[model samples]
Target: MMKKIIFALLVLVATSASAQNGITNDFRFGQGEDSLRCIETITIVNVNLNNKDYATAYTAWKTIFNEFPVARVDTYTNGVKLLNELIKKESDPAKKSEYVKELMNVYDQQIKYLDKLQEITKSKLSAGNILGKKALSYIQYYNNAPVDTIYSMLAKSVEMEKGQSEYAVTERFMKYSALKYKQDKSHGEQIIEDYLNASIYIVEVLDKYHASIERSEKKYQEEGNPRDSLNAIGYGKMIDASRISKSNIDAYFINSGAASCEDLSKIYAPTLEANKDNIEYLNKVLSVMSMLKCTNEDTYLTAAEYALAIEPTAKAAMGCGYRYYKKGEIDRALEFFDQAIELETSITTKAELCYKVGLIHFSLNNYGKARAYANKALGFNNKYGQPHILIAQCYGAANKWSEDDVMNACTYYLCLDRLDRAKAVDPSSKREADKLIAIYSKHTPKVEDLFMRGYEAGRSVKIGGWINETTKIR
Candidate 1:
């Protein structure tokens, strides 16, 4: 473990000094009591290192100590101390490299720690905050927010903020409060009250930082990059420190985790509504939302409608529409199903649509339309029981009862045998043996003569039915 740590330090130093010699000694930048500025500077330096821009690296390092005296900020003091050590040990190129690595490792650690502290401060002053565990996880991954988790974390923060003002003043709690403020400005004061001083200071810092980020972000926007879509979503309009903090929840969602479609909607909804230009992103999210089934009926309809606008043939949209139809929302259901049928080319899907349309017509008491639809459904899937049933109803409704109807019903019964040949299954069908007997019983003398004739015929043919008919003793 010790060697691994040392090696990591060495790598940073080597990378920092590889392009030029004695660059470490010239490095010095500090923030005098401006922790936010100090962190931002370090982030900029790190960015320079990432791009391998040695000139920027050298300039940024010199600016750190020269720009701000180390006496004012502990973070700057430690940063300077680490950098100075690298300079003094600059005799050995290899050793200097190790020092560079150590410097980078320390810088990264400080940035992460500061970020956490800032978040805590923001949460403490606010109406709510996430758990320390989750915040740590987010910092570790640098990924998007886990949307489902935000709800739990926010609820927990609100509960914590209410219990003790001191607890609320903590950095984590302050971050939570800021987030809540963004979600609903009306509740900002309640949460922001917990850490008044930190809240005030961080607000100013965030303003400077937010502006810098925005300016830099604008360049990316000019290129028509699709990724800028998230930032373009109305995060800019929210300026209150509290709202800014709370809205970071949306940032966390988009940046930190793999979220479902519904999750994306909740996060982007506010921003998308505020900025009409973000409609593209909103539509994208809505597309996914349409595919997702929610327990809430209203949400399903809303998502389905929006999704159909993007993808007319989406199965989820059709399903939602069908549900609406089942629940008596005929117009809405028809709209969805019609789109699905128009867009889908699969025979099975077409059959399903036909069946649904027929059923809908039947429910509306449109017998002629119902018959037409049922016939169309059967034209594609003659063996499907529901369509067969629909056809039967259509005939019965038309008062067109005939022997053919009975035979058709019998064909449906035969279809059941194909479903499971081993187990004889009937969909509430009554035994027809007695009915057959009654029909035969009506033709007494004719039946008797027929029986006698059948016996004569069977005697010559040696058939089973002739013997059965010839048994007149009964």
Candidate 2:
């Protein structure tokens, strides 16, 4: 036992001397001595950490973290693990919190030292990344911390990192924002701003990942099926993360009830007058209002008009079109819808614009124009079920323009045909298509009417007027 104690003490002295030497040479950047010392200390720290010897690792880790903080990124990462283990073993809550605070300080030191080291080593350790790790630490270990304090850290981290933020940080940031809103109604605008900022950043990240996936897919095809060069797995994880973040954030907003039209009106009305001329602010407000389906509110019109006056993009044009359409002004709505469709370049967006225009024409009782516009939408997106349903409704309403009972009943056949097309092309609309098919089947030309019109059940007949579709008499 005496020999074992002496051996352990000798090992401890050797380790301490080595780490002290590393601390002394930490300031000598680009020197062989400094590099050797850093490597030596790092190896020792990592070995202890890897072996789950947190007590031993913590001593060496602190030396490297404080002395050669920027020498290796692993110092901070490994320090986190070591501190977490120490905190977990502590029975006292206060001591655990102190360890958590030390962990946070380690992250802060990383940001400070990494920035300096980047100038020397050309490393890519960003301040935003360090800040993100700090925020995550607070969330993971300091859950009992003050909400405002945690929220501020998360908000700053998100602002600094933007689209490069960690998925977990974004999620926690929104949760705190919601909590803050519930605790104090006065912070409603801040909550909205936080949500919008997080949403925009999430969308940007998703767009980047989608673009990467596209490039990867193209590379995979060009590589002739070996498939090893494909970054599909990497990009796929990013895509899934973005999607889940979006869905979770959206659900949080909806369940919070803070984004409802009534809430938004109360929140945004005062700010609107002040920011009416602030084009960027107006656009953001209009976007959020539109996303929350508050287009019918007066605030939406105000914001839309402000945004349009500054810049007439597809978004503003669509807002104006929907506003007028809701007011029963079909001509004005059609004009704006056309402008929106012309201004938009995305195929999916164009399809939606065309569908909106078709709906307006249909509402105006212009069956021919509605059918034409609906077909235009299909040309852009062949699988667009809404346009197909709109066209069917137009055909069903065409009976109002028919004079004879036989012709009126025949319009239902045309309507049913379009409904069938909808089901065939878009499986998402299958249930609705089947329900409409059952209802419209009863309206098909009666046997007596068909016979009177000199039409047999299997005989093909030309439907005149606006609808030029041919259908077999049923």
Model 2, position 434: C-alpha lDDT score: 89
Worst 10 residues of 2 by lDDT: 21-30
Model 1 scores worst on lDDT over the 10 consecutive residues at 462-471
Candidate 1 segments exceeding 4 Å error: 1-296, 314-336, 400-474
After aligning candidate 2 to the native by TM-score, how far in Å is the CA of 368 from where it should be?
14
What's model 1's lDDT at 289?
A: 39
Across residues 1-474, which tens digit of lDDT does each residue of candidate 1 receive? 645643443433323322222213321222122333444555556666667564465455555544432212343334445455445646887766555554544444434344333432433223232233334333333235543344345345444544222222234444544555556656533432333333333343334434544654685677766556455333333223333352343343233223444554565455543543443443443333332323234444444455555555445457567678758888887877766667655443466678778887888877667767766865653323456455445433443222333222222222222222211211211233223334433322332544554532223221121111111211
Q: Roughly what TM-score does model 2 have, to 2 decimal places?
A: 0.64
Against the correct fold, how does model 1 do in TM-score?
0.25
Score each candidate by Cα lDDT: 0.44, 0.75
TM-score of each: 0.25, 0.64
Task: State each candidate's clash count.
Answer: 48, 0
